[model samples]
Target: MKVVPSRSSEWVGPVTSQKRASAIIEIDRVSQVFQTSARKDHLALSNISLTIEEGAFVSILGPSGCGKSTLLYIVGGFVSPTSGAAKIKGQAITGPGPDRGPVFQEFALFPWKTVLGNVMYGPRQQGVRAAEAEAQSRALIEMVGLKGYESFYPKELSGGMKQRVALARTLAYHPEVLLMDEPFGALDAHTRTRLQNDLLNIWERDRKTVLFVTHSVDEAVFLSDKVVMMSKSPGCIREVIDIDLPRPRRRNELLLDPRYQKYIVNIERMFDESDEAGAPS
Candidate 1:
């Protein structure tokens, strides 16, 4: 495994010459403000700027209320920033499009629809013929490890299975980027780990650009090429740490690897320091 240098928040240099040339998503000085019932302005994200290279798995790791999901939604074009802009492949993002797919923590599956029906919905909506859509959906369901459960409805599947269907549905339309907002957050520890491993395996096939938001340090370190740490509310970039571990990472091996352990320890320490810094004097 090669040692990779981490960059501070102030470091504006590109990750590498190759990545710099193929920047797939660009967020330029984006800020989000919301008005509370009390009539005060609440700033969620403050002047966040980030560049994600094509096929890179990037994790947005931050504390709760740090606007991590808000940022993800911005890139998905689900919400408009108060200022600045987000772009995909050089075009400004004005609204949600098939180019980006979002998988949320809430399974968001149609309880009325079975696994096959749910996964096929996206393609059918895109005007794909029913037979073709079913074929693609069945393949995706199998790829997500739900081969025999295609006919099962959301109510009949486990939480993990539901999430898998959600993932397949998102992938059905062939989005260029995957915006995953704590997609595994609702699962038990064992289930979450399994899904994490499964996600990496599926990701290895096509290497779709993924922007994953999570509060877990270990999860971020394990799944991402770069982990972008954010500050507390009115979140800003705190640091961007590049994971230098060799690819095709296995959970059993990574658990024993000193480098992986160090990354978790160091990131936790940074979060602790940030908390202390924000404590009232």
Candidate 2:
């Protein structure tokens, strides 16, 4: 797996009168493996290291089985690495905490809950009063452009709308970091594009630290300030490309740009090479 240099040096943590803050999430020399049968081992991630600045948008891109989702879970504290450290701010992440919110691709909304109820759930768990949670939920629902859908249950909403509620629920927690695992993967192409644009718009406004994982190269290039490409199998950082493209980008026009295509091709080549290496000898 190819290793990428860190671009997180620019990320300044929350300011205080004394010491300066650090990156919101930092992974150093992380390797994760799972055991199968009696002794066979499968390394899902290997020697991966990266840092995400507070409030910066970053995406992990690679082909399937590249351990992208595993990396996301590591950041979310849902799983621990077999070795190395995953830290939030300056603290070690040993388990899940309210400080980091996660959005799964499956939407994962409870079928029994209304949009507002789903959004309010996080805050309620965080010990916020019912009324306060409701108010926060209402504002976040509107922020995700789901204002009128508040009373509707998950089953009543379209796939895109359901994901929006899931997103709002994560936001309602007001997490210091947000982790998303291909949150738009199941949507139709048109819906995917729309939701991608909407997500970028909301992100720019909300300015939360985001660590998004996806196999879609376009999605990574479109939404992230930096796209961290990973190698397949036993995933590791291949390259960290600074997007540098103007924000609020139009999909049609940006896709046509030669520079945008360059990043996509670069990531594509890495995936192809990794696949070749992983093939049976």
Candidate 3:
């Protein structure tokens, strides 16, 4: 049956309701803890409350040991929370599921498998056939700027290239949301900038919900629509900075923007206020 197009509903989803897709994921007053060897408890995240809209590019930025990664793991379903809830599309997250794709900083690719094979591994486990999965994997690899290196193993690729393979692997599964844990943190400055631009291109084309964790203020500002800043020592969200910068932002142009520096300074002040010792201006 052929459906008729309506003038009012050019955007996807229900005609009357256009909220830019339901809040794809939500973290409500959640806390995470791990038991110390001394038999005491250590809180990692403390009451992290946030909502990520579908197709939005969001970044979580904080200092070292602020539980930024722990929060990301909870959203990715790799770890359970100690209190409160993490929900995806109104459903509570129980454990790891294919609906969310996680790209780690270490670029965990299989040494034995070729790049193409590694990317196809996820779908193959989900019962997808070899031929189709391979084709899709190749497309993704090429999309991530690793076209001709499909036959190379993880050991044969550079640090940046290995990360590309890991990201390709995550995309091949066709996940609804992408959880990136400092994917570019391991790369040198030059390679990191290149990958950051590449990732922005991919995000524009695919438009998937993404929650990226990064320590670089510039990176967080460049790649995100909103930057969620967390406090240190039993982390809690301190601020959320909305990036009014234009889309498809170039690295040089974005860095040169005065607003960029302003936002960075504001985030720094937030951290200072959260801590007992505020940095002298």
Candidate 4:
């Protein structure tokens, strides 16, 4: 199925050449801590730092309990760091705003609303007029392959479909940065793979700065320009691996490419050598 992108999001190929690289989002020595019921301070992240250039698709890969999601949350402004800061365009992020849109592991749609209503919710709240919001929402619904189900409520949709709605909703508001935390983690193997490819197409078209978190090696290898691995417990960057493979990456070809396999192996080695838990590449 073809994704019908709105003219507002016209195609810019996956590997479009740019004049100069510039950092759009900066994670500066960020750390996070939580107080346990016993009053012990539980440190979740320790001095994590990263800089994502504009229009780059970067993935945060780590095992369970690695605090990857916490890092993404801080960047999304849904949570504040204990120290340091998450900044976008050189401005410190204080709270959730229109500039950065987040799609979580769980689909957070309103059960009472239809698919169209859910997609339109963000723009309407942001003060876009009804007619214009509907036009943009319909285009996004088509992009995510939910055009025919516009009137269907969340209860009527499958897990993958609900996630698609969540994605469509996020894209409808035209965020410069898309912060996704395990958006496809809940889906079955086939659905997960399908969405991964589709997401690549969407990213290629829009060129938004993507900060994605996942435990899957194949996912990181196939989708990201850079893959940053994290350590266990008090998560910190173990290594930042650059994926040198050409973009408009085809999954079947990537599976067979020697460089792709090397990247996967190197990523796996980072975890194996460091005693950090990980999934098979």
Best candidate, TM-score: 1
Per-residue C-alpha lDDT of model 2 across residues 1-281, encoded as one tens digit per residue: 11122345432122221212446778888999989788889999999888777777889998888899999999888999999999887899999999999999999998898999899988898899999899889988998899898999899899999999999998998887889999999999999988998888888776788899999988998888778888866678777776766656778888898867876776677678877887999
Q: Which stretches of candidate 3 lie over 4 Å from their true place?
A: 1-21, 273-281
Question: What residue runs in model 4 are displaced by over 4 Å at the alpha carbon?
Answer: 1-21, 276-281
Give the range where candidate 2 is weakest over 10 consecutive residues by summed lDDT. 11-20
Say which candidate scores most in lDDT.
1
Q: What does the lDDT read for residue 65 in candidate 2?
A: 86
Of 1 and 3, the candidate ahead on TM-score is: 1
Pairwise lDDT winner, candidates 1 and 2: 1
lDDT of 3 by residue, 127-175 (tens): 9999999888889999999999999999999999999999999999989
RMSD of each: 3.3, 5.5, 6.5, 7.0
Candidate 3 residue-wise lDDT at 122 = 95
**What's model 4's lDDT at 207?**
79
TM-score of each: 0.94, 0.88, 0.89, 0.90
Q: Can you give the lDDT of residue 88 in candidate 4?
A: 91
Per-residue alpha-carbon lDDT of model 1 for 1-281, expressed as tens digits? 21233545432233543445678999999999999999999999999989888888999999989999999999999999999999999999999999999999998999999999999999999999999999999999999999999999999999999999999999999999999999999999999999999999999888899999999999999998889999876788898878877778899999999988988998899899999999999
What lDDT is reached at residue 59 by model 1?
Answer: 97
Global lDDT of each model?
0.91, 0.83, 0.84, 0.85
lDDT-based ranking: 1, 4, 3, 2
TM-score of 1: 0.94
lDDT of 1: 0.91
Residue 40, candidate 1: alpha-carbon lDDT? 96
